[model samples]
Target: MSLVLHLDTPAWRAHLAATCADVPGLVPVAKGNGYGFGLDRLAAEADLLELDTLAVGTTPEVAEVRNGGWSGDIVVLTPWSRHDPLAVDYLADEQVITTVSRLDDLKLVAERAPRARVIVELLTSMRRHGMGPGDLPGVRSLLSSPQDSGLRFEGWTIHLPMKAANALAEARELSSAAASTIEAPVWLSHLTLDDYRTLTRELNVATRLRMGTALWLGAPNTRRTTARVLDMHPVKRGERVGYWQHRVSQDGWVVVVSGGTAHGVALTAPSPGANLRQRAVTLATGAMDAAGRALSPYTIDGRKRGFIEPPHMQSSLVFLPGAATVAIGDDVPVELRLTTARVDEIREVDAEA
Candidate 1:
């Protein structure tokens, strides 16, 4: 009952639906530990979203999703490897689409998986995933050869990180170029409402945006998590507790509540009060070194407590003043970094009680 993440699935689903409403043909991405939901569950949620295609990070994951009966097109975002064609074919017969960033890897994949669908990824803002513009011409030449038959060029994909306007702008620019050269849909990422709306009026080609966070976790900031407080303790200024040399101070309550490093309850974002918002997380750890004090999300006797030390792997210590009545089995609400933590459970808000 303690240290569990009670996900508001309905609220999360509604949020995704609302976000994807303006963008037509949204392809929800489920990759990398399923962003903490453990890929399989995210696959189920994506299917529930009625998506025709899902973007995963690897060829191995394709079987995990396909074996579960997810027949949708498995689009592997990672570039193709000549070392593995049989693996790709098994994940997708005609529907599995693999991404290629290097020109040399293209022909190799074609030879490996004769019937594999392939997507040529162009380098966008996130240079980590695609091929540079100079390499595309040669790759195009390789694919157009009458002799090559195994791998078919399905579409183009652009993975633009977090830049809402830039992502759409780059998509439009790439679409104009791809239209003149090849007849294929262009896949995209990190787009906003206005970006898609802008693309609709300017670009003519089919564009599909892949979304993971927006689809599963909803707004990064709006979703709040909660847990139940399991226990509490009374201690003095020099009282000792916890593993290692951790001790209690302030001559107050030694609060042991539900949620910890394991529950996804600790905050990764810098304190909201920080002057610079994004770097606050790193800055906080630095502050802890200077002040010799550690803090975490702590709710006490119904009043939220402040962290007294760095969080333990399974539990954390919160400092509470006297007069607080928080007891064992009492529930506490917390804000967590959804990207981290185990995401032990996903539940509704009504069940938050």
Candidate 2:
């Protein structure tokens, strides 16, 4: 028994084809657990779709994508730096396009691997990585030198914040600034289809949109995640159980499901809480956590269950109240964040099945 993700092959492939048809110059991103579908699987899908380029998150991922059977131009989204020990290896490969965000890194690429293909990243409101517009002049001078650094200028890239209200305006302004210094294609992320069209029409340079989540998990109904029930034990009120020996509040069954911390269960990223309701929910969840009681993602009889204690490495102790009935070997539906989740198996089913 294990945590499994079931994918509808025909429906999922149809969605991919539809997304490709809608977005021109689409660069499929297969980074960070490949959005819950391992890199090798996504790499094979990219090949099947006949895409010419794939984008990864780091330098080491270059070989992963290559070995995964993706034999096309692979672009590393993370900017290159002297500190990156693995950067030098991929720099000499023509198919590997390294991202250069800082002036010094650009110089380093020019000095170390002059023949390397490079994408100069411009800083957006995200402020995470990339060179600012003020650094454009230095970048222009380096690339336009008489000595000719021998680097292939791939394009300019801008990664906008997901929740930015003026993402399109920011993209337009930054892209225009970068274009004035050097002419090349503009690669971007987090722009809507209409916004992409508007930017393409306004700018003279070509544009490519790098997409991961929207392209893969956009159709939520096409995929299903389930955890198998491994064991169950009845417990009376006030009885202590689990590693911490926490006392139970009511009579219930301690349902041991096949998922835990190792599988990304109970582990969560910090929530920013954009609204009052969200903040309230976060606060409530925090209170529950403080009380040593928290809700589990696993659901039974259309109701969310509660965890008896912190999840173990390979299984979780869920408190199923007396009203509900569950049996060992039964599969329980799980609401999971795919990007963080590591499932034991991924089963693909045809539409007819």
Candidate 3:
């Protein structure tokens, strides 16, 4: 019994091919849990797509991509620091491009390996990483002469914030600012399909879209997540169970499913949106939390059930109403945020003509 992710290979291949056709210069991002498909799988997929570049989050991820036989240029999305000497050494590979957000990092890279491959990240609204616009002048100067810095300048990268109001305008503004500093293409993320198309057409500079979610999880029907029903117990009202000894208010079935926090099941991440509607949803969720009746991602008999308690490390306890029917060996479908899910097994079915 395990948490499993089944991929409709034909559907995914078709979808990925269509996405590649739609977005030119698309660099598939392979990082962090490999967007639930695992990094090696995605890297292999990217290679099959014959893409020229693949972006990853860290040096370890870079190694994973390469080990998966992706010989194309590997761009490290995260910024570099002197603390990571091994990562710096990895960047020495001509095919690996390290992102440098701070000028100090650029200086450090220059000192360590002047001929190191580099991509300068311009600070965006996210403010999580990247160099400010003012700092680009220093970046341009340091890398302006090969004799001075010896760094192989790649391009500028800007990661936009999610659900931006005027995303196109913001992109235009950032592109203009960055274009003025470096005469290189822009590597971007978090743009909608329409935004991606528009930016490619309207912007004078070349743009490369670094995408993961939309490319991989864009087709939900093609991918299925399921958990096996390991055991089941019938309970009457006020029966105590689970580690917290959470009591049932009514007669129901406690279905012990093969998924839990360790599998990234039932684990919640902060909502990326903060709009009024989202805030109201947050309040409603809070009320559910207060009532200890949180809706679970697991579905039984084509209907989602509620968690009896927070999921255990390797399994979960789900409460199904008295009338619900399920067998111990049955596989229950689950809806998961792929970015956060950790599937124990992945089963890929060949596409059908």
- Top candidate, metric TM-score: 2
Return model 2's CA RMSD, one decimal. 1.2
TM-score list, all predictions:
0.84, 0.97, 0.94
lDDT of 1 by residue, 103-187 (tens): 7776666666666678888877666867777776776677666356556777777777674445666778776776555667777
lDDT of every predicted structure (CA atoms): 0.69, 0.90, 0.87
Residue pairs of candidate 2 with colliding backbone atoms: none
Question: Which model, 1 or 3, shows the larger TM-score?
Answer: 3
Show pairs that collide, candidate 1. 7-347, 114-150, 270-280, 270-281, 296-307, 298-305, 301-325, 301-326
Tens-digit lDDT string for candidate 3 (1-353) = 68889889899889999999989989999999999988888999999999999999888888788788899999988788878875778667889888998998889889888889888888888888988878978988998787999888888888999767887788878888888877788888998879888888876778899999889988887888889999999999999988899999999899999988888887778875577998888889889989999999999977889999988889999999786499888998988778888988898776563
Q: Residue 172 of candidate 3: its Cα lDDT?
A: 79
Sorting all predicted structures by TM-score, with the top scorer first, yields: 2, 3, 1
- Provide the global lDDT of candidate 3 against the true structure: 0.87
Best by lDDT: 2
By lDDT, the better pick of 1 and 2 is 2
Off by over 4 Å in 2: 145-147
Off by over 4 Å in 3: 202-204, 350-353
**For model 3, where is the 10-residue window of minimal lDDT?**
266-275
